[model samples]
Target: MMKLWGRDTSVNVQKVLWVLDELGLPYERIDVGGPFGGLDTPEYARLNPNRKIPVLEDGNFSIWESGAIVRYLAEAYGAGKLWPADVKSRALATQWCNWCQGSVYVDFIVNTFQPLIRVTAAERDSGSLAAAAERVGKAFQILDPALAGHDFIVGDELSFADIEIGALMHRYFTLPIDRPALPDVEAWYGRLKTRPAYQKHIMQDWTTMKIPGA
Candidate 1:
């Protein structure tokens, strides 16, 4: 059996979990990081030098970084399901996966989520939060058109790109912020919600991460 390390509430960890479930791969998950607080240990450091959550151990092989783990699982196990068989299609999927991490994740987590959820109301900077929201919204605007005629990021079928980007949809929609009207993006999110794996892993309650009254 494979082993995974991370807390369930972590969005990065949830991305890996979603992929594992989607591929029907069996794995044991050990809680660490965040309030669980096992990341600083030497053993944990050996698993992931960055001390990040969501490390995957397959027998003697170990892989860290949520995006890499997701891609590894999809390519190794999912093939035509999550990993696109065509070279060009796979490239496109990888492109969106990187875009989600590079463009969407930073602004959403640092500028928006941390300010609104992790910080106290008195400490929250409305200006920065609003700016982040705008930037994230613009990022989604680029995505909305790409999803206009497609149900998933790459094509009609679910792909690694969806798992990478859709992992953040729950937070993006649930966060208390002004969002521009994005019909295609909203429709894509609705499609993702219909998946059992997505619902189980991505739709989890995240109130634990939020400060009281936040």
Candidate 2:
């Protein structure tokens, strides 16, 4: 059996967990991070020097980085499904996977999400938050056209790209900043909620985040 070390609430960790659920791959999870901090420990650092949550160990291979792990799992265990076998198609789908890290999640995390993490501690920055939201909204505008009529982000079929974006979308919906209305965004997100694996692993209660007004 494979072993995964990370916290359930971590967005990055959620990515891998959703992929595992999608593939129906059984694995053991060891809590590490947040309330249970072992990331900087010698053992944890050896596997992932970055000290990030979600490090996967399968047989003799140990992998770090949430997105990379999801891609690997899809390729190794779900070639035709989460990861398409076709070259061009796979390239297109993978683009959004890479986009999610720098585009969708990047701006949002820098803005609203940062302040929300230490809510009761008082570090809200209305100006910066609004600016970041504007940037994030612009990215959504790009997605709006891309998702015009598609159920998933990549193509007609579900892929790791969908799962990656879906996890980030979950955070946006739960963020303190009121969600901007984007019909296409809403519709795409609605489709994800219908997926058994997505709901089971991604639709977590926001209250647990203890993100103040959450």
Candidate 3:
């Protein structure tokens, strides 16, 4: 059995949970971090040196980093569903995943969210937050255009790429931030909203997010 450790409301954790749901994979989730707060313990650190939540433990294997863990599952178990096999196809899938982690994650979750929602207003870095919002808005423009004719991020089927990017989309729409036009992103999200597993997990008030405007 796969065991996940993180709070339900956490955006990082939500991504992992959302992926598991998409793959129809069963796993046990342990509440940690945020309100739960077990990430700093020696036992927790034994799994991840960074002491981050959303660690995935399967039998003797343990992996950290939300994106990596989701990818591992998709590659190992999901295959054609979330993990593409062909070189070009897999590259395309991974392209969106990398963009979510590198570009979107940095702009929305890291810069703006870290300051605005993850920390209190008094403790926030206003300049960085505003800059992050600008970058994210620009990045969304890139996605909005690509998603114009497509229902999902990559391939005809719903892949981990869609699952990965959709998690960030939920966070972006919820935040009190100015956003660019994203009709396609909106449509894509509408489809995701219909999933039973997404409704079961990912949607809720954040309990321990440190961002300010949240």
Could you tell me every candidate's TM-score relative to the true structure?
0.98, 0.92, 0.88
Clash pairs, model 1 backbone: none
The residue ranges of model 1 lying beyond 4 angstroms of the native Cα positions read: none
Lowest lDDT 10-residue stretch of candidate 3: 205-214
Q: RMSD of candidate 3 to the true fold?
A: 2.4
Assess the local accuracy of residue 3 in candidate 1 as a C-alpha lDDT between 0 and 100: 99
Q: lDDT: which is higher, 1 or 2?
A: 1
lDDT, model 3, position 18: 78
| Poorly placed runs, candidate 2 (over 4 Å) | 211-214
TM-score of 2: 0.92
- The residue-by-residue lDDT of candidate 1 on 1-214, one tens digit each, is 9999999989999999999999899999999988899999999999999998889999999999899999999999998799988999999999998898889899998889888878888878899899999999999999999998888988899999999999999999998898999999999999999999999999987776888867
**Model 3, 90-154: lDDT tens per residue?**
78878988887777887776687667655777767778787789899888788887777767876
List where candidate 3 sits over 4 angstroms from the true fold.
121-127, 207-214
Which residue pairs come into collision in candidate 3? 116-212, 117-210, 117-211, 117-212, 118-210, 118-211, 119-210, 119-211
Best model number under TM-score:
1
lDDT of each: 0.92, 0.82, 0.79
Candidate 1: worst-modelled 10 consecutive residues by lDDT = 205-214
